[model samples]
Target: MSATTPPNAPQGLQNSIISFPDPGILLVLINRPKQLNSLTVEASYELDSVFQWFDNEPSLRVAIVGGVGKAFCVGADLKQWMSNNKKGIPMDLPTNGFGGISFRHGKKPIIAAVNGAAYGGGCEMAINCDMIVASASASFCLPEVKRGVTPFGGALPRLMRIAGRQRATEMALTGRPVTAHEFKEWGACNVVVERGQDVVDRAVELAKLVAANSPDAVIITREGLKMGYESLGVGDSSRLFLEGWSKRIYEGRNMQEGLDAFTEKRAPLWMDSKL
Candidate 1:
């Protein structure tokens, strides 16, 4: 539902998500247990909106995404795919692509708290996040090849960027499950927890650390770093970005509060006045 609604509010079919503000972190959980938390058309649109919401919310510097069922996500509904294929009609996809937030970039950081097997599009979902903290029981794979298709949701390309060309090739060609520990070793995930300990808790811990920083600074740094790495050619762009933020920060009250708090030896009370 509505972002203003509490997380414990009744869940609906179209809105199978529960989001609440936890200090500087926005806790988002998928509430679809049936179909293994499969992403529906409505859910996809809601996710796009959610990304925009998070982007505008200056108080929320970090986001933690997790699923409610035994698996994070099983990808698209095969029955729907078959039905549409039979009728010679293509499904209307969200603007960001296969899954709502898979191929898009946001201004803030999102940490995937993967608690179980993430396959096909699910794997892409996890990879889309800035970082991942997975449970020991968690596994990841892009097995679209086995189904006579390919993982088109940035899976192939993102995996290659994170895990290197050789590892990405092996995972894509084999369609085999990669354990969370192996993924950690491959630099695919940030941390791997034991099966019993709450992986979400681990993610929250990391989120809190990120939330401790200046929200604007965090957003600007992430944007600058991402652009610098992805740019075809880079030079004065970094300087331009810093200069732009330098001007914006001074215009906002938060920057002055940050300086005041530093001198006073206290934590700055931050609010998203822009929102």
Candidate 2:
């Protein structure tokens, strides 16, 4: 099923569609198939709002992003960019960055269900997601340098940290596309689906697995993982992480439910995270 707008969703969404595909899971699909899911400036800001709403909504635990057509997202609307340039307008991205996924430091976890070419900012989005589940046919590339523009949406450092400098350098300099399997080897892709498997279905299954766990653990653990990637030293990372999250998780009702359920051999009845 295609993504559709919610009755009271954040406004200004001319593109990108949102829906609750499963219990506790929000699905955001990039809907510009004819344009290969390239995002216009207005659409970029609107998506930032969408994700902000996702993070704020208590019932939603996980989000999956995918494309409606042959490409996940090819990045900026360059045609629009050139038009804006001719008119002296700036094509500024939202503070949350591309599709509100790249450069996002949100509290919740997001999973990218890559079905096709996740080029440019699309690749950026996948790289920044807490996890990625990609189709075998999916490919990733950063062709910004080739287009006479740099990937200014905060992906370079993150990509270099995740995929290593050599691999990152090669992809950026040559704009070479890497297959899903190869990216999995680079530690960029979490799961590479086999041919004929539906990427979104696989991603939904994974998202539900996360949603089933304690929401507090999911957020706290996600913070720890992000710290590992972004922090220079574990001392500072652990100190800051502990100061903020350690108390909340330990004191949270879900923690008690989790341990009690495990001891009793029963399913956990988790509460929504108050963190």
Best by lDDT: 2
Q: Per-residue lDDT of 1-275 in model 1, one digit per residue for the tens?
A: 12354343334436456465456677667666677767766676776667667777655678888888787777777777788889997767777765566886777888988988888878898998888999999999888889999888888887887899999999999999999999999999999999679988899999888887777667767777776645434666667666766677667777788899999999987756462
The list of candidate 2 runs beyond 4 A from truth reads 1-12
Tell me the spans in candidate 1 whose CA falls farther than 4 Å from its real position: 1-15, 232-237, 273-275
lDDT of each: 0.77, 0.86
Global local distance difference test of model 1: 0.77
Candidate 2 residue pairs in clash (backbone atoms < 3 Å)? none
- Report the number of the highest-TM-score candidate: 2
Please give the TM-score that candidate 1 achieves against the real structure.
0.88
Per-residue lDDT tens digits for candidate 2, residues 170-212, read 8888998999999999998999999988999999999889888
Measured on C-alpha atoms, candidate 2 has an lDDT of 0.86
